[model samples]
Target: MTPNDPIDKGDLLNVIKWAIIGIVAIAIVLAAMAGFGQLNVNNVITLLTILAIALPIYYFVMMLRSSKVTKVERSRVKAYIPLFFAAAIFWGIEESGSVVLALFAEQRTVLHIGSWHFAAANFQSLNPLFIMILTPVFVWLWEHWKKQPSAPGKFSAGLVFAGLSYMWMALPGMLFGTSGRVSPFWLVGSWFIVEIAEMLISPIGLSITTKLAPNAFRSQMMSMWFMADATGQAINAQIVKFYSTDTEVQYFLAIGLVSVVFGIIMFILVKKINTLMEGIH
Candidate 1:
């Protein structure tokens, strides 16, 4: 491949830098949480503040090193903005699904297999653990698969996987009912499934955004990519009210079905979307 044919070396470096930043930041945050043996408002607040400051500085440095883009490239970027927009909502749903699990997981109050009692944010912390275990598995599968999926196909499948994760919870809710404590494995399974969806969405979403992005707005497009996360979560805040013990099954089914349907739609339209993308995948 030529220097700019597959991907520009500089942009690839920027992606590598941010990917490292994210991984290292998650590791540090999880390490800090582990040191305290749990999460609390104080540590979370502090870490989040540090992250907010640190991420922008990193982005700023990269932006300073970036060159300007062309007019044709700018026009191409505008058309691709919708890709990021859709990704954001799907990302939001994925996030909101975790919050739902955390809400119910805390309610159980005890895990008989261990001495540990349920704590606020305790279930939420399992995300990093699962990510560690499952990431390489996902990477191997994606890399070794007979055929590769386009960006739209992967993104759409991610949404469906997220929906499937919610549906995974609905099974226990339907079978065991929500009256009292059930099993920890239910939450475990849901987290595992969703993180698979993350493997599909998060990194790929970043890559697609940059590849499809206009030259002038390369870095800006990356920034906009995260907006999908915020947008999905914000929507989550509003709709999450619908999730509770009594409504748990319904909520899971609703989100799950919606995600699956959209995934199908995107799959059907993947060819059209790919055409619009020109060469980005």
Candidate 2:
């Protein structure tokens, strides 16, 4: 397909529809596997390894098929460097915190809910439940706010709320002492906070990429965003490995500190970046 192919709103809608379908399909498969006792940790690891092998092959095919590949000018891309780094930091800390929470907080404690032994890992899904309930309210409020002159500032305020989510874990660490039994609610609460931060940053980042990338290379630019995420995941694995020796309090504190700092930096830069983006658009 040529870069100048007419942009169809329907195509975008279809892509989104298919993506949701794929997610539901995968979820169903995973649920079935879990029910069948085939979705253990080893199986999940093996599936990830397979995808790791497959991703490069898919990228190579895309590279081969496209002829309009013009190098994205470093000067242009460099303007987004701060946002990219912020994104990487956010992703890395969120991922690493999940590992630390699971390993130190969740695994160390077990809840016997009647006849079932509920692993702390299962509680991690609570964030999705919260998102399902809160997303519509958030969207409605966002739309209403957008009608006001000060909407951007109001929107950026969400970042502060997101940053405060880290304190949920921090306060508990201080109170109960990180080594002792703690409620699983903290992880869910932290996830809910980060989810808000995610709502603020991620869509804006994608919109920025859509605007900043050269028209011909927009798909490649979006792919690079995913690659950045993969890079963060690799770095997260390293962080988890390196900090394995540290106490739960130490790891959570470090991750929370990084997140809070990154959130503040991003919030400070958002207005400037918004102006720069206006110039580009």
Candidate 3:
């Protein structure tokens, strides 16, 4: 067919129909499992989280296959798939500064220094505060540095740092024990580390999303970046249930290890991912 000819819609329609059927089937099975007592609240949420991550990806792949997308475009988008998940995992930890970290600040941290006292809610400001402080420094660094890591490399490093933030929280419980209130610096430090990860992942991820987007689905691709954050928070809703005074150390260690391990795995795959990116550095 000529380049001017309209692409066929049949494949796209079929993909939509199949995707809906598949999602419905998975949801029904999960619900049935819950009804039969095979799934607890956490189990249900975990599976639903997988579904949340997978569904959009399923549609994205189908759309690419059905459309008039080029090989180069397809490869770049494929490269973006792994990065998307990495961003989601990073966001899961980063966004939790408000929910999980805030809970820690309120319930576990000692909120005073010397004669100074502050609200636990005030701790939330540390995120934006650190971002503001670090942004210019990082901008200058990226500009002056002749060699920088690829987006995937930055993301991998970001995940490690994100994981370390959680791991750092585990230390307060470990060193001082999990019962009494610890110093507020622990919370501040965790926020500081995760915000560093945010600097590595957030802006870089946004830039790479624009660079990698297919011309036909430019807007949708950007939406997918936001969707990554949403997906992370959705998963957090389930995992955060496991956190409490007694489970504090275990919770932090578990989530932190997961992020760190995934970061290492991503690092190992960097060369492969770079190849998939096809020169969009």
Estimated TM-score for each candidate: 0.69, 0.63, 0.84
Better of 1 and 2 by lDDT: 1
How would you encode candidate 1's per-residue C-alpha lDDT over 1-281 as one tens digit per residue? 23233457897998899799989978887888888786776556556555544554454444444566454454446445445545755776667645766677777424555775656476777778878988888789878986889887887888788878878878987887878888788877888888888888888887887786655556566786775666566556667867778898898888888877877877787887777676666
Q: How displaced is residue 115 in candidate 2, in Å?
A: 9.2
- Compose the digit string of candidate 2's lDDT tens values, residues 37-151: 8998756655554554455445444443555434443334544555555565555555544676566555544354457767766766755676687778767876787453222
Off by over 4 Å in 1: 1-82, 108-110, 114-120
* Alpha carbon lDDT of each predicted model: 0.71, 0.59, 0.89
Ranked by lDDT from best down, the candidates are 3, 1, 2
Error of 2 at 256 (Å): 1.9
Cα miss at 37, model 2 (Å)?
A: 36
Poorest 10 consecutive residues by lDDT, candidate 1: 56-65
Residue 130 Cα positional deviation in candidate 2, in Å, after optimal superposition:
2.4
lDDT of 3 by residue, 22-128 (tens): 88998898789878998777777777788777866775786479465688989988999889999999999998988889889999999899999999999989988
lDDT of 1 at 274: 76
Of the pair 1 and 2, which is ahead by TM-score?
1
